[model samples]
Each structure stands twice: as structure tokens, then as C-alpha cells.
Target: MAEIRVDKLHKAFGDFVAVRESDFTVRDGDFFCLLGPSGCGKTTTMRMIAGLELPTSGRILLDGEDVTFRRASHRDIAFVFQLFALYPHMNVRANIAFPLKAQGMPRGEIRTRVEEVARILRIAPLLDLPVSGLSSGDRQRVALGRAIVRQPKAFMMDEPLGALDAEFRELMCGELRALHDRLRATTVYVTHDQLEAMSMADTIAIMNEGVIEQVGTPRTVYEQPASLFVADFVGSPAMNFIPFRAALAEGAAEVRIDDVAVPVPPLREAVEDSELVLGVRPEHIELTDPNEAAPLRARVFGVEYMGTTQIVTLNPAGGGTLKARVSSELAVRAGDNVGLHLRPERLSVFRKRDGRALKSRLHEVPHG
Candidate 1:
């Protein structure tokens, strides 16, 4: 296992900048994920660390040894590409031994290393089978074995499971997590899939454009998103951002979104004439009785059943669209006026200008 530190990393192609000055560190034996949409420089960032791409300017350190100018082969890091690149002519065993062979290990040592890695990846049973006939899942396991045979300091996975179907992707996610747990390998997984990062990584770096929008554990990034982009990109169905004016009353604050009037989490100091955003997660909204007090009303527009829970889309009774995941038996069809109860405990308040969190007075309340 190794610690990876990327300091002031930057990448540029002629005139177009692919990555800007960025800094972050991945602890030894941690599963860290770099997440973002296409062309967000995530691949470029990963490549720089692997010595596959030279940073325009910056330093990459492996366990405190500067390796920015080191060759990819000299770095001794494993890379698993999005597509499996197994040699069709070789069997799984041979493929797994290829890395060892390239490193000039003794024949007997190569055989032992290959067998051990195959066992770790649970692909020993198919070692004698030709690589050409393996399923995608099996091929991926073989690819993993091939990478592990060399005993690299770290593993870099670039959407390695992107080729698998949904079911296989989900299954591989679990397998990958378990494998990492067992090996305690320092891993850097790059993906555009937020759900995968949220589920598998110990820490996630949410990148947008060319810079890291936020970096933290999955729970922190999801629960206390540093910015609006992080908030919108990390959650499923995404968090709702209702624009409202913050009104200071006698001792309370009110947020008016559409025709709905809801009490905003009180601010520590009065924020007069400021535009505030009332952000709530879909999972926090509940479908409730029409006569419920202080209920925000919305008409149902769509419903998606996910076996365990149903996603309910509502036409904001005020004027926007809101999505809430409810129980399958909640039973609300399109055009049904449903009341929603916002979970204040999970609600986030953001300033419209810079999307920074507003000061909350929740802790200053008179009683617990």
C-alpha cells in the first residue's frame, strides 16, 4: 500500500487547459474515487499520478518520494483500463503471468505469483481456460489478477466496470469492495458514476470543469455538500433547490417558494434582502395527508418503482418540479395533489450567489 499526494497538478494541451492547479491526498490503503462527468479531467488527473501523462506543472508523491518525472513502468503502479486488454492467444494463467514475466521474475516465481493472484481474484478455476472465451465478469477478474501479479504499490481503475451491464455492474461493485477490503490495497478508482463512488469509496473527489468541486467522505459530500454543484451531482434524483426570498419576521424566518410558504431554518444573524435556496433531498420528502399542517402541496407527475422504494415526481403545487421517493403502497397517481413534509434536520440552506452554507440558528434554540 502507498499514499498518493497530488500537489498543484495542472495539465494543458497547447491552448486548452484540461486540468487546473489541484491538490489532494489519498491515504495508504484507502479506496479513493475521482468522480465527474466526461471531459472533466478525471482521466487526466489519474494519468498524471500513474506517470502516463505529464502534468503541465506540479508534483506527484508516492509515500513522500517525488515521482512526477518517473516513467509509468518505473512507478510500479497497476492500471486497469475501461476495456479489458487480455491477449486472446494466452490462457488466463499466462495472462496473469505476463506482468511477472515482463518484470523478469524467475519462471517458478511467476507461476507462484500468478496462482496466488488468481486465487485472490477467485479466477483460479478458469486459469486453464483460453482468455477468448471468458465472460465480461470473468475477464475483469482476470484483468485484476494480471495487475496484482506484479505486486504494484497502488491500483488505478479507470471505469473498469463500465463495460458490464447493470446487473453485472452492481455485482462487480460488491466484489470489488470485498476484494479491496481483503487486500487492503491503496486504490484510485475513476468514474462518472456517482452511485458507484458513493457505495465503494472511502473518500470521493467531486470534480467539475477542471477543478475539484469538493473532497470528503461519501457521507460528508452527500450530507454537507460544499457547493451547489456537489449537492446536485452527488444524490440520486438530485437534491431539490427551490428559490425563495428569506423573510425576517418577529423571531422566525420564512421561505416562500411558489405558493408554498415554509419556515426556513433560522439564521444566526438576520440576512435581510438576501436570496436563499431551500435545499432538500428527495429521500427526506414524504407523501402525506391532504389536510396535514404546514404541508407543501404538489401534484404527482410520474412514479418509478425501484422494488424497495418508489420515486414519486410531483408538479410543485407552487410552480416547480419536485421528486420524492415514497413507499410502494403510498399510492399516489399522476395529477393527484399530494402534500410533502420536508425534513428540517436534513434540509440545507444555500446562498444563491456563491452557493455557500448560510449560518443556521438550530443549535441556539431555547431547549433541546
Candidate 2:
């Protein structure tokens, strides 16, 4: 029943708008993520929800109760910060029990709750270890322990995994997801990493420059981005954006890139022949032999051999550079001339003037 609804929330400091007319809902027990790059107002938005920052104009409702002006302590929400804000003088057990002790809970009750959280986080073995002696990952676990010991209505984690190494961060991502499944605690996690957000969040709100760009499940945002900013930001290696001209061919909307008349999905509305941006992910493009009749020709300028797959960079003869992710087994090398084919169904078209997506064929196209 701990659903959070934000209605037209706005925050401003001096002349700068940190957050702008934001409205979103985090469903009961849902793992929601506020995702965006630095200074994008994600952390600012979370601070407003936690009552750490006052709103300029908006309503914040938790479980049907209005709490816009409530103090942080009164909201009963726990915050796990980006830095492991642990007390170096205290042991793990003491750190986890601090919040309960602050509430005047009995010693016996505090001990019980601390141990329970320690077990859940799999840090029971290190309960007696001083926070100073712990590793980065362990310190993060202890910080989480302190937040969960109180069993707050919702958990607000701001880049809790940012300090850990890459391998350990991946491991923690799985552990955190599993813990969410068990607790089902309404969680608002803030992070700039799209991979982390995509892997963990049940719902994602992508933000940029004091505005929310898009909000949806990971697949929805990745496959059918609403704007050029979203389509470029959400994918790894980023989506390839190339300038093209739109036209009508045989009653279907089409775009020409390097004289290649590629059919595109139907637009929301037709436009006069004009410049448009063609958006496609590297993985969706196929590489072929130069001798073939493919519409595009390119020289392989670079090849990246990722263990699982290879990324091939090409300089198209017509213009801009293109990247294609292919299998490691593909015998492509630098300096090799290749034919490039656009998977028309996988393309996205955007109006060149404003960089807004005009059409997406995500549902109609087949993807791996």
C-alpha cells in the first residue's frame, strides 16, 4: 500500500531550475529508478521526495497521505547515499542498530532487528568487524543494513553501487535485485548508469537537463524511445544517428541515406519531403560482401573484439561513420571494404528540426 505519487513537482534555487514540473508514480513495492546523467536533477528530485529539499510547487503523496512539507524524519523513508556514510568508530552491528537506538527501541529489540538485516544482506559473518576494516562492498552492505533495519515504507538509494569495482558492482546488482524480491520494499534508486538501471529497475524515468525525457519499462524505452535524446542515451555504444532525407516511395514513407531508399515505419503524421535523422542501433545493421548489390559501401576503419561479440566501425563512402556489432567469427578486419544493409524494420525516424522521434517500428520488427 506504500504507493508514492508526485504531482507537478518543481524545484528551483535562485534562478536555476533543478527540477521542472515533474509528475510520476512509484507503484506499491515497485523497484523504480530515476536514471540520468550528472546534474540532470535526478538526485534533486529524490531529495524532494525524502523531504531533504523543499519543493517550489507540487504535491507529494505517500499511501494517499499528503506530506509535501513534512520533515525527513516524519516521512519514515530511509536513504542510502552514494558514499558509504558509515561511522568508522562503530562495528557493523552498532552501525545497523544506530537508527533503532535513536528511536529509543530496547536493546534486545535493536539487536534482533540488526541481526535480521545482517542475515538478509549476507553480512552476518562481519557483524562484529569495525566499519574501518571493511572493504568497499562490505561497507555498502552495512550502509544498506542500517537503512533496512527500520523497515521503512520505501528505500531511497542514490548510486549505492557507484564506488565498487566493475566486477563487484555487477555482483551487487544481482544481490540487490534478489533482496528486493524478498522484501518487496517500495524502492527509488537513483543512478546515471543505464546498464544498472536497465538490469534492476521495474520502471525507469530517464531525466535530462531538469526535465524527464521518458518513462517506461526497460524494454519500452530501449526499443521505442520517444526522443532523440532517449534513443541515444539508453543504449550501449549508443544508437547511430545519421542525417537523411524523407520521401514517399510506392505509398510508403521512405528515407534516403547515401542514395539508399530505405523503407521506414509509418510516421505519426506525414511530412513534406524534408531532412530527417535515421536512428538505428549498431547490432541491428548487417555487414555484407562489397561485391554484393547492397545500397551502402564502407571501409572497415576499426574492429573491436569483445569476447562475446565484435564491434566493427566503418567509414561509409557516402558520409558519416557507422558502427556495426557483429560476431567474433566474422572475418572482417580493418581496411576491408564491406557492404552495409539497413534492416528497415529496425529503423527509427526523427524530425531533423527538433530531434523528436516521428516513428518507431519496435513492435513490428524482430529482434534478438
Candidate 3:
């Protein structure tokens, strides 16, 4: 229901910086995700937005109003924690009505709000039960109900599904996204799990070491990572990096890796660094006969079978190990020598000096 903005937001605990000059926006009615590894400052950033923690420097704006120094209670933002923070002494109905009651709403109005939120969350049947006796999943629903009943300007969730088992977490992911769609509320979700972020977020801000690495739609972040850190952190198998030394002029079409001329997407700018890294996703690699002339060659070290595909581990002659996703139907075994062909259009070139991705044709166009 609001647009959230952070400008040069910085946080520090004495000498150690928890967040550094971060900047981003959560458009109104959008499901925005702050994604990263542990201690990457996502939680701190969210807290600042919710008015739970004061930023050491910079500004936080909610719906065009500065709330940087406002108290959490004054922000009109609801926060859901990873552990379902519900009152064990209270029944589900009472728990969900707590916020309205605290606001001194009429008793009848509180009852009406509680019932509406319970119905929306599909938790109406458990309204009379004690929260302590509920299942983890049910308790989580109650937590969500409590937050939803507030009708706040925005909602902030910090890995609300992290307490559930794998199966329940997956199931809740769908339920949560659907709830957002129904409410169309401005939601800021923080999580370290890439799968959750990729599956649920309308836009994702990938963070690391207190810095925002890249912010884009899920497909854009995955297909055209802005930096090396983003390329490795946003994928399951992660992008494979083939390290080599080369100096090239602008518009160069190819580079030599192990004396093999591997075609690459033309560079938009010259790369003066001799140390460069070639990044390719596992699914883009194709295995060919070793005897055939190809850009690169490797020996098959192992195969991991999935239902429709297999992961072929290879030891490239140019050094370093690589994995290829291939059809499981293809016959391949350990110790089999194979030539490797990378899809040229999908290649990413990065400078090792700063771990920054090089500007090239591959990144010039926006990914669908």
C-alpha cells in the first residue's frame, strides 16, 4: 500500500559496519525481496525500514514521508518474524485481535477484523484453539493472520517460513505469494534462500557484505548477473567460471583458453586486465566426441542422474573442474574423454581484479 525508499542507508555497531550506503525502492503493492547470505545486512536494512532500528546515516521514506527516526509503533508497519511470535496464553482469535485491541478499537470492530483476517488466511476454523496447541504450520498461519488484521501501510517478513520443514516451507511459499496477490500490500521480505526469493519475489535485491550487489527481476538477475558475486550466489549449481589471462581490444569476438579459441559475445569495451574469468551456466554446455575438433576438451569424471537430465562432471584440460547439464538419455560414463562446446551467446566475461562483470553484448540487451 506504500512505496518504500532507502537512500544511502548505512548502519554500524561502533567500528563494524552492518550495512553500507545501501539504496533501493519497493514500489507500491510490490513483493520486494532482500536476498543474500547470512550477516549480509538484509535484516538490518529491513529493520530500518520498519522503524525498529535507526540507521547511523541516510534516510528511509515510506509513502513519501520520512520515518527514519520514528518509533516502530508509529510506523504503521507490521513485522513477522521467522519464529511465529504469538502469545501462547491467547487463543487464535485473541492473538489476531491483539493489535486492534491495543489501538482501543471498539470490541465489535476488533471481532469483525479478526474474523475477516482469519477467513482470508483460511484459519477461521482454528480461531477458538490455543496457539500453543497448534501445529507449526497452523501457528505460522496465525502469525500471518495477526499481521494481516492490522491493515498496516506495509508488511515486513524476515524468513517467516524458515521455522517450517522443507515440505511445509515449499507449500507455504505458494500460499504466501497468493496472499500477497489478494491483499496487494507493499511487502518487504528478507531471506537468505535463493529459491524462496526467486520463486516469490516480483523484484529481488541481491546483497552481500552489507552492499547491494544487483537488483532486478528474477530472470534478469539469473541470466545477466551484474557482478561475479551475483552470478555465483543467485543460482543452484552456480555459474562455472573458467579463469584465464588475456588482454583484448573492444569488440573482440573470441579468446584463447588453453590455446583453444573459444568464441565469446563481443565485448563492448576493451579489457586491459590480463586476468579475466569466463562464466557459463551448466545447462549451456554440450558434450561432443573427443576426436572432434572443438574449442575446449575435458575428461568425464562422473555423472549424476536426475529424472530428465544428468550432471556430467568434467576435468577440463585448461584446468579447473566444470559441470554440464545434459540429457540423461545420452550414454556417457566416467573416464570418457569429451569435447566441450559452450553456447557463445550465453557467455559472461568478468574481470578478476574487482570481480566486476565486463560490459558486453550479452549484457547490453535486457533478458526476458
Scored by lDDT, the top model is 3
Model 1 TM = 0.90
Clash count for each candidate, listed in order shown: 0, 0, 1
Q: Which of 2 and 3 is the better model by TM-score?
A: 3
Candidate 3 lDDT over 252-347, as tens digits, reads 989888788889889999977579999999999999976888667899999999989999999998678998999999889999989889998899
Per-candidate Cα lDDT values, in order, are 0.86, 0.89, 0.93
Model 3 misplaced regions, further than 4 Å? none
lDDT of 2 by residue, 1-368 (tens): 29999999999999999999999999999999999999999999999999999999999999889999999999999999989899998999999999999999999989899889999999999999899988889999999999999999999999999999999999999999999999999999999999999999999999999898888899888977878999989987889988877654333556777677777675546667788888889998899976787777899999999988999998988778888989899999899999888877677887778777774455455466
lDDT of 1 by residue, 1-368 (tens): 89999999999999988899989999999999999999999999999999999999999999889999999988989999889988999999999898878878899888888888888888888999998999999999998888878778999999999999999999999999999999899999999999899999999998988989888889888877767888899988999988787654434565666656676566565566778788888988988876565457788899899888899988875688888988887777887777788876667777788887665654234222
TM-score of each: 0.90, 0.94, 0.97
lDDT for 248 in candidate 1 is 48
Total residue pair clashes for candidate 2: 0
Runs in model 1 lying further than 4 Å from the true structure? 247-272, 359-368
lDDT-better candidate, 1 vs 2: 2
Model 2 TM-score is 0.94
What's model 2's overall lDDT?
0.89
Better of 1 and 2 by TM-score: 2
